[model samples]
Target: MPVDSTGHAIVAEGLRKRYGGTEALAGFDLAVPKGTVCGLLGPNGAGKTTAVRVLTTLLRPDAGRAEVAGFDVVRQAARARYHVGLVGQHAALDEVLSGRQNLVMFGRLYHLGLARARRRADELLERFGLADTGAKPVKQYSGGMRRRLDLAAGLILAPSVLFLDEPTTGLDPRGRNEVWEAVGSLVAAGTTVLLTTQYLEEADRLAAKICVVDSGRVIAEGTPGELKGAIGGDRVDVVLRAADEIPAAMAIIGRVTGGEPESDPDTRRVGAPVRERVAALTEVVRALDEAGIVAEDITLRRPSLDEVFLRLTGHRTDERAGERAAEEVAA
Candidate 1:
C-alpha cells in the first residue's frame, strides 16, 4: 500500500518527559513516514525506551505534542491504540495459553468477530512459523518460540504501525535473523515500524533511517550510509612488525595522509583517513621505507557504526559512566 506523502504515521514536536528531578526527553522531535521503518538507536538510558512509551501512549510526555496514525497520542489515545501494536523487550505471553489461543484472545480484545479473529490467528500462526506449535502451551515453548508468539499476538489486528523495542535482545543469531525477515515482510506489506535497539548492527541492517539518542535527546539522524559518510573519507589501516616503531610509523603515516594517525597501543596498529588512496599509500610507503618501519599488513576500510558513534559522542556506547549519568538525568 502506498502511504500519503503529505501525512505522517508518527509525528512529534518538542516532546519532553521528566521524572522528578530527571529529564528523560528534552525537546525531542521526530517524523516517521507511513510504510517505512525508523530506528531508534542508543545505549541504555538514552531515553529510547521512554520515547517509545510516550509515542505508544504508555506514558505521557511533560511537554510538546505527538501523533500516531493520524490520531493525537494524548487526546486521541484510544484511536491511536487502535491503529498501533507494541512488542516490548520481554515476551508478553500467557504461559498457560496455547499459541493460537493467545493470538485469538488479542484479536478479540481488538473487537474482531470470532470468525475473523480465528482467521487472522491462523494466518499469523502460519506466517510466523508457529503453525505446528499453535496447539502447544506457551510455557512449553523455547525463548525464540515465545518471542515469535508474542510478535504474532501484536499483529492479530493488522495494526497500521508497530512499535518494536529490542525485539531480538534475547534471541540467538538465527532467531534474530528470522525476526528481521519478518520485519522486512511487514514493511513490504505496508506496515510502518518504529524499532528501538542497542545493537549497532541491528540498526544498520533493519533501519531505513536511524535516529541516535543520547542524554535524552536526538544527537544525530540519518541513514546508515549517510551517518558513516558524515565521519568523512576512507580509513587506511597499517599493522607494523614491531610495537616499538609505532610512534615512527604514526609520524610517517600522518605526514602522508595529512591527518593524525591513531595508534593502538596493544596491537601496534596505526590508522588514518585519506582523501586520495593511491597517493596516500605511495607516500606512506616511501616515508615508512625511510624510517625503517616495515608494515606487516595494509588495508583500506570504511568506517563502521561504532566509529560513527564514537566520533559524535566522544565515547563508546558501552561506557558505563556515560550511561549512568544519562539514567540519573532521565530518572
Candidate 2:
C-alpha cells in the first residue's frame, strides 16, 4: 500500500532553531528524494535530533521552511503528521501487552477500526519478523524485537515518510542487524525514511544520501562514498613497537603520503590519508625500515565512516556522546 508521494518527498530551506543560548539549527537545508532513505549524520548535540523534531512538527523552527511528503510542516501540520511516522531512540512499547496488542492499540489510537487494527498488527508482525512472537508480551521481546515493534507502531497507517532517531543506539550487533533488515524491507516497499544516527556505519548501510550537521548547520551532504572521499581516498596506518619513535614515523609518513599524519603517542601509531595506495605503502614501509623504526603493524584501507564523521564534525563521536550525556545528567 504505497502512498501518493513522488519526486522529492522532503525539503527544507534555511531552518533555524535556538534553545536559549544554544543554536540547534542555523540555516539548515535538505532535500530527500521520494522512496529513498536519507541520513542525517552527526555527533550527539549536533542538531540532528533537533532538525528531526522541527521537520516532524514537534518543534517549531525559529526561522526557515520545511515540507514533508509535499505538505508544509508548519502550515499543514495535520496533513504532514498524517503522512510521516516517527520512531525515537528509546522503545515506547507497553510492557504488559503482547506485541500484537501493542500494535493494534496503536492502530486504534490512529482511528483504525478494531478489525482493521488487528489486520494491520498482523501485517506488521509478519513484515518485521515478529509473527512468531506476536502473542508474546513485549517484556519478553529482545532489544531488537522491541525496536522493530516501535517502528511498526509508527507505521500504523503506512505513512509515506518515516523518521528514525538513533534506532540502533544501544542494541547489540545482532540486534542492530535485525533492525537494519527490517528498515531495508520498508524501503523496498517504497517508504521514504529519514534516519538520524551518530553511527556512521548505519548511514553507510541504510542511506542513499547523508547530510552531515554540526553546530546547527549542514557541513556536508553527499553519498557515503563521496563524503569519505572528501576526507581522502585511502588510509595508510602504521603501529610502531616504540613510543619514542613517534616523531620519526610521523615525518616519514607525512612526507610519503603528502598529507598530514595523525600521531597517536598513546598507541605509538601514525596514520595519514593516501590517494595512491600501492605507491604510498611502498614508500612508507621503505622509509620506516631505513629509519630503523620497527613497525608492528602496517596496513592500507579505505577510510571508515568514523574518519569521515570526525573530519566533518571536528570531534570524535564517542566524545560528543559523552559530553551530551554529562550535560543531560547535569540538567
Alpha-carbon local distance difference test for all models: 0.83, 0.86
- Superposed by TM-score, candidate 2 places the C-alpha of residue 209 at a distance from the truth, in angstroms, of 0.9
What lDDT score goes with residue 160 in model 1? 91
**Model 2 quality (TM-score):** 0.87
lDDT of 2 by residue, 8-116 (tens): 8988889999999999899998888989999998777789998999989999999998889898889999888888899998998899999999999989988899999
Q: Which candidate is the best by lDDT?
A: 2
Off by over 4 Å in 2: 1-6, 276-287, 299-310, 313-318, 322-331
Residue pairs in collision within model 2: none
Model 1 residue runs over 4 Å out of place are 1-6, 233-241, 252-260, 273-306, 315-331
Minimum summed lDDT over a 10-residue window in model 1 is located at 322-331
* Per-residue C-alpha lDDT of model 1 across residues 1-331, encoded as one tens digit per residue: 2323266898888889998888889888888998889998877778889999998999999998888898888999998999899999999988999998988888989999988899999999999999999999999988778778888887877889999998987677777788888888888999999999876667778899999888788899999778756665567889999999998888878888987579997887999987787788878888888888899888776554455567888877666634432332222
Clashes of each: 0, 0
Cα displacement (angstroms), candidate 2, residue 141, comes to 1.4
* lDDT, candidate 1, at 174: 76
Error of 2 at 130 (Å): 0.7
